[model samples]
Target: MNPNDHRAALADIQVTAQDVKFSTIVCFLAWTFAVYDFVLFANLLPVIAQDLGWTAAQTTGINTWVTIGTALVAFFVGPLVVDRMGRKSGIVIAVTGAALASGLTFVAGWMVGALGVLGLVLLILIRSLAGLGYAEQSINATYLNEMFSHVDRKNGGGASRGFIYSLVQSGWPVGSVIAAASIAILQPLGGWELCFIVGVFPAFIMMALGKKLKESPQFRARQLVTQWRSQGHTAEAEQLAREYHIGEETGVSPLKAAFSGESLRPTLTLSAAMLMNWLGILAFAFQGTLVLTSGKQVNFNDALTILIISNATGFLGYLFHGWLGDRIGRRNTIALGWFLAAFAFAGMLWAPNGSYGLVVALYSVGLFFLIGPYSALLFFNAESFPVETRATAGSFINALGQVGAILGGVLFTIHLSGLTQESAAELISSTWINAALIWGTVPILLSAALMLLARDVRPGRQS
Candidate 1:
């Protein structure tokens, strides 16, 4: 390409400072809302289970089903939908779908008297609809990666990118804090159903913000290339292709592209790593909720307090790990997080019954390490793939993680069901060490090992 045409292409794709700021804010808000919706359900699961006549086993079953549905949508549906509609439109639709589905949770409560068992079915269906929006989380990752490509390419930009990504990733704990506060404040006044009603607000806010988002330049460039090719403007198409370093066939099926040749190794390795990581996460999230509310370890009030404090500390981990990822390396930082988290989980398991401070500290540290590298992993995963298949590949890896979560839930339920209530209570109170060994320690160590096999894909770093 000539200098004039090269400049023109650059002009068309360059992102301004304002665009970066706006994209970051909107992406952060989108993540915040997504986690708010997700964690709210976990927070209120006990109340919902009681209202719907669900036993502990049944509750886990519902979670498994929901996760399975989420995986299916994220893996099979997300790539096709996002690739067709564009990321911005896909996110808007997802946010709206989540909000609408969440609102129906309120209606589920009303229908219980008239529909009885059918209310349970309706509620599960509604929950699955909300789960479908999990795709937006992956879409956001891809969008952020692409939107900041120019910044990420500069010298010393990796750390800056990691910091920004961490800030956005902190939305998970922020949303968790919101969920905790909502339950502590609102659940007492109007019950869990009302909390679901309040949860709908953030989704709409995200939808409004998402509407103003511009398409990523990489995506737009791909579109322009396609248009030029279709118009038989071979010269312009080839010029743009060379400028962008995009391949001739830019529109290959994402799934085919993701699993083909060199991409397959990292893709499979990351998927395995995600699976193990999520197993540990699901175990802690669901089992912690049970241990807290069941009074096996602590009272509901005390549990909520512990959760809020732990999550607040975990928020700091998100930022710290992001910076660490840039400084050390993505794989090393993530491995360090896993190693620390394994020890923290052990500490939580062995704390004495009356050692509230010890337990809280252990839980907080464990939560921090467990979640610390998540943002970095997302950054790593996105960078691992080319623009054409980034979203699909990342979403597929996340879908595999959801499957691991489902398996975790099932295992927890099966174990719980095998013992009498008294024995189960005793086991939880005493044998938590064993539980931690299987659920938290083992899985995380495995995840860390898997990270060793996967290449680091940080920007400005060679794989």
Candidate 2:
């Protein structure tokens, strides 16, 4: 590549400042509300079960089935929609799908009496749409990763990149707070069904905002490379390849590229780590109030308050780690956070007395590490693969977190038999400590360990 071709390739990839901020704002809003629906379901799970007259065993069964559907649906968004269509398209579809899921969730409540278990079937399918919401992170991460490439580290744009992304990923804690608080407020006004409606409007607005987003430069560059190569314009193709660091596996399909040669190791290790980490996230974060209530640390009413407070504090973790990841590296930041999170949770679970303040303190510290690392991990996953396979591989890893959720659900159910006799308020399990430790702390520790196996996610970092 001569200087002119190199300059041309760089010119093609350069984006305006407004485009950057616009993309970030849209991604943040899209992620925030999508996760709002996901967390809402968790917040309302026990209520949904009680309203539908499902016992503890039956409730976890429903959740597991929904997660199975979510895992299946996840493949469609990342591999098919994002990789095949475009990153911008994937964002719009994912946000819209999540909103549609929320509206249908309200309908599922009514159908239980009319359709009986079939209504639950409807609920399963509707909730499965969260697969789109879950996949949105990878798609947005890919888009933002490419968008931020032009910004130089020496000028502080690189650290700002991490901070910028950390702000977007902070949506998890924001969503959690919204979900828990909405239920607390709306449940008294009507029922848990009202909370389902809250996610709908904001999601649609984000979807509309997402539609206007520009296709990522990397996506456009990859397409140009393939077209030029096939048209026998080898000079242009190879030139862009040199400038943009185009991936070697360009000839193969996106999904296949994800599992082949250079892409395979990080795909395997990162996917495995996410699987283990999410096992803790699903069992503890999703059903956080129950973990507190079931373990006898706090009663049901107080548990909600604890969840809201503790999750709010978790916000600080995202900023701190995001800033930290840019200084050292994303992989190191992620592993270190999760490793410490495991101990924080263990201390919370086994404290001599389950005092409210102490429980809140320990749980807040635990979540700070547990969920915070994702601020780096999501971006790490994006940078780990080339633009061609970025969405597919990242989404594949994200989808497997559902598999972890399935594993988490299994652990939750296996221990629920003894705790099932009472309603959620009076819920107590002599096995709670054992179950929490096994499913929560144990898997989180393993998740941190798996991160050590993967390579760093710097520029063109995929192995």
Candidate 3:
């Protein structure tokens, strides 16, 4: 087999079990708090809107705009930061940026008076900086994929990687819960400004912990080749490339390489799938409180309670999907989960009103399928690409997902604004309900179909 760019697949890095444990802990906490920052913005925006004189429509607009900036920032982080810098640097900067975003929210309202509407612009700009943190999911996948590749190489694939990475990916639900629970608890005590300020601490702490992270061995190896080539050590570079059995694309742009040749199909497919899945996320999860509160008898607090409970179920789903991916395959696991999620969500929508117990049950089930597969999704996405383009591919697809978020947000704003006050009040009766159905269900199913187009690279021991 030319060792054929496969020898460096796992890069015989000297990662100890302790290194894995330590990196996982750091990634988990960083992602957890990054999510805390991300989810908190949505949950507390109503209060922030109230304080800032924005209508619900305006709040949605702000979210959409921020997502645009977030997509830009996320793209920059993946290719410019993660690809250009080391993974360790990328992760550290991500958490630190999230901390900065959360801390700056307190001043966003004050800017309206000084910068006029541009004050709000400043707020969007500030929040979008957390896009780096949002991109942390990609960093975790690439970092851990490299780390996990070294283990059980004798086994056909890195059997335990998906399951272990699932533990880190659970940061999403944990952070989401923390965001909601903190708002429930803290909003009354001071204000959302307090919550925003409070949100900064955890991310900052995680950034400190991220400092302890060792660079991924694969990344170091790649850098060594690049360095050797740059220093005119062409023979050394070629020899190392030959030794590792990898193609030497030393100076090629990772993003460009990601789109060329065989990388092109998976890149396009994965990007589209994430875009569709994220549309679903925006419709159901991002605007979760709205979906539950609309046309239902539940108050905001009750809706919040349901969100807290339902999202907790995501933690279990991650573990289960992670475990399942190890046996069957990460790609298959993601597809099955998302496909089932469509029906479960349909059941959620179809159930009769006044059945709060039934609503909660269906909603939770839907989320279990919807959000759970992500535990496998990130790792699968990472492994699908060659090492050279791993971070770029992950980030590129992830950034594309924000396009779905933007589209979903715009659709939500249009639908919500079209609703008369009375019509908007009814959950099942409004065109808004159809909006939910389209964004929430159809996109999920499509994303699942797209995943089937994926041809994943199986794990093998480093040559």
Best by TM-score: 2
* lDDT tens digits by residue: candidate 2, 173-274: 988898888888998898888888887897658756866787777777777787678877788788877767786544677778889877899999999999
Question: How should the candidates be ordered by lDDT, best one leading?
Answer: 2, 3, 1
TM for candidate 2 is 0.92
- Model 2: how large is the Cα RMSD against the reference? 3.1
Report the Cα lDDT for candidate 3. 0.79
- In candidate 2, stretches whose alpha carbon ends up further than 4 angstroms from where it belongs are 1-13, 153-157, 248-250, 352-354, 422-427, 459-463
Model 2 has an lDDT value of 0.81
For model 2, give the 10-residue run with minimal summed lDDT. 150-159
The residue pairs that clash in candidate 3, if any, are 5-245, 5-246, 295-427
lDDT for position 93 in model 3: 84
lDDT by residue (259-374, candidate 1, tens digit) is 98667987999999989988788766545665555533787778878888988998999999988887888777888898889788877766667688888898889889988888
Per-residue CA lDDT of model 3 for 1-463, tens digit only, reads: 2343435533543567678789989999888978888878877665666677665567678899989998899888878888778888988888888888888976775676578677877988998987877898998988888767643443345657778888999999999898888888888887777777766787657667877787776677677676667777687677766643457764678999999876898899899999999988887787777677663446678888888888899888999999988888878888999999888887777777678998898888888888899998888887777778889999999899889999888877876665543443563345545777877789999999999998865532242
